[model samples]
Target chain A: MSVIKTFGKYRNLLGELVKKDIKLKYRNSYLGVIWTMLEPLLTMLVLTLVFSELLGKGTKDFPVYILTGRLLFSFYSNGTKAALKAVRNNAGMIKKVYVPKYMYPLASVLSGYVIFLISLVVLAVVAVVRGVYPTLQLFWIVVPLAQILLLTLGSGMLLSTMAVFFRDIEYLWGVALMLLMYTCAIFYKIDSVITGTNGWIFKYNPLYAIIVNFRNAVFGQAPDFQSMFYATAFGAVLMLFGTFVFYKQQDKFILYL
Target chain B: MSEMSAVTVQDLGVKFHLSEQKVDNLKEYVIRILKHQMRYKEFWALREVSFDIKKGERVAILGLNGAGKSTLLKVIAGVLKATEGKVTRSGVLVPLLELGAGFDQQYTGAENIYLYGAMLGYPKAFLREKFDEIVAFSELGEFIDVPVKNYSSGMRARLGFSIATLVEPEILILDEVLSVGDVKFRKKSENRIKEMFRQETTVLFVSHNLAQVRSLCTRALWLEKGRLVEDGPVEVVTEHFEKATTK
Candidate 1:
């Protein structure tokens, strides 16, 4: 009952913020929402074409593999990066008017989620065209998707809070994300590069864990339950930490911002 | 005291830390911070200030520049956290610290009404029902469809004032936003605000215009250098404030 009441009160505010964010992004552009889908599809096409000979040899249905990893990585990266600017960009409103500050980051992340959802349409189309037929296990995609969503929200909140105080966290995070891209195994199979004890690194990389399981579901194969569980746990912990840091530091934001 | 008072502030203080050397970007800030080059000085904007507003009281805050008047209102509005002390309030409060603070310049005036209304916590359904009323009140007719960036300053202020005052909140905090629009529109806004006064809405207003303050408010609090100097009837406090500042 309390949860429902709280949601009832803030739901409209949240919806309005998200609407404003989405509209603002696509405003004044002719292509508008089409660009959200087009950009990733084009990226998948180019990467698949360029790297198919070099990196695609070890992976089956290489374009789908690259697209899946690329889409999820871009979603997480873009959401948190936008969130880094959320608090500072709204400094005008924050200084003059009062609303829940976290709403800015929440809306930013949710808007990126909207773009990510649009790009998923491209992913589905590619998977089907590549002859990777769907199965009942494809419903299992929801679990890893949920994990990514949680992780994105958590990262957004954490980055936004620190970005407010340091101003440098954004630049630092940019470099970190680029490093993350190579480690996430978007271009090649983990088995091709690492073996034995060294394989634990890829297993522990949360994105690799989620992406591998996601590919398994799409291919009608059973998921790696242990990897799936580890990824979920990793996302859950980060989300909790992000929420805790954001709330604790929010009151001081007016001073720093 | 407890039953009739709408707001109570006890020894409220707000301190802002001003760093002398500015680094707008994070890269420089990180480098400076790592080298222990970051330095900040504490500036107490409001120091141990206290006040109370009774239910249905229209009180004006009078002060010179840098006297912590806006800081006091901001603290009460929950925009700024108090460095020390507490604020207690009993009713739904709305603070118009800066008119159209969140309006998107790229959006049409019509779209901004919904955006502004939503920022003030009005649902879209409520705004949709009052859409005609707000546009008519703003007197922006055909121009409402154009982007807000093209509108004159007065027109933008009119749109903001119209949407904000459309809903009657229990307590209104006005930070010199009423002195907006042309003389004709100012008169119209004065009349609209008068309606709220008739309804006995508790108001905390900040303004330098003595005539407006005396006309609209019953009591006044004069702040000097972040400290409360006097609290009395509006006429008496304004008279004192005038002579002291002018001398």
Candidate 2:
């Protein structure tokens, strides 16, 4: 609820750091900004070969499947990678500034969004080339994008702040993200997921609904309303908890830093 | 001392905790889920500290290293929350706790002034208009466009002191900032402090240099082992503090 104040207070700081992240990363690269596309494109190529050529036998629209999974991966993996180091990395800035401290995590979320924007453009161009026309339903992506952003923010907020107090949280988050890839429908369809008891685990994951909705919107399929609601509710709870921890311990950051 | 109490702190204290990083292993981190232990049985940083300063009273808090001077100043600034007691302030406070600690090293001196000004809650337009005055006060000359990391410690301190004094804070908190510059620049900072006092700004001065306090402050408090040992005329308290510590 206090997102306005939390966001507004650290906007400049976050904006500056995001600029630094982008600028610092691409400065020396030969490919430069193209790395954003090249990265996901390479992942899509590898997975498309293994999943589509080797195993996508009966599957229609294999490229869309791979593209959807790549989009989801771009957000979660890149988001968590930025988030895992967000606090430890910003030790210099955090020690001096009196910000909400969650701004560091929020910055990672925004950076991920920036990268996601790049991938979205790439996917759209490829989709057009493959004879998929833009649909009016495609406009509904704004909803899932906002939801996944909040969902990523919630998770990133928790990890980034905790990473300050407990340095090992970063490593743990790395492992968690690795395991989370399979849990989310990143490489395969959720319908092909395990049935019964084990299926409940995948069904409840926030990224599950997020990726499903994104695929649905961009591919003209209907979304899972129940899972989206679950993800939204859980994302809210995680965000609130993240904010609660951040606000409560925000001032103590000076001492820790 | 003036009639109005500009700042009051009653029985303030702070404690800290420490833990080994190994306790935060992956298995324990996951199992405990960061069930933090706030009490590691660490020593108290401050305990039962109390003092007050009236409007326009240049009260210096003098103490040795680790005497809780900085902690008390932080408590007053509200940068650090007190574990106990209340700090009542009559108006806005600008706590210059550590000179230049908040300035970015990569930014030029000019950019840092605005950044600090914004952090200190001064409007951008005000900083723009006051830009020359700040530059004149800093005396950094052509170096104003250079990053602070390239500046000497004295240059950094001068700019920090300049920006801090630029704001018209009703309560000014200075932590050993008087000795940062050359004799001429220090004199300038002293004059600025005098000007602030003239304007009814309550001054909470912290320093190891007793002479500055004797000249600038009317009342002085001596902190020993995080407790107020004496509070009175500047000369009397410094003498008492010197004698007690020298023993």
Clashing residue pairs in all predictions, respectively, total 2, 0
lDDT of 1 by residue, B44-163 (tens): 998888888999999999999999998999888888999898888887788877788878888899988887787777878999999999999999999999999999989999999999
TM-score of chain B of each: 0.95, 0.89
Structure candidate 1, residue pairs in collision: A167-B26, A168-B26
lDDT of 1 by residue, A160-253 (tens): 9988877778888999999889888997777778868787678778987888888888888899999999988999999899989998988888
Deviation from native of the Cα of residue B211 in model 1, angstroms: 1.0
Cα RMSD of predicted structure 2: 4.1
Model 1 stretches with alpha carbons more than 4 Å out:
A1-7, A53-60, A195-197, B23-38
True contacts kept of 2: 0.16
DockQ of structure 1: 0.61
Superposed on the true interface residues, model 2 gives a C-alpha RMSD in angstroms of 3.8
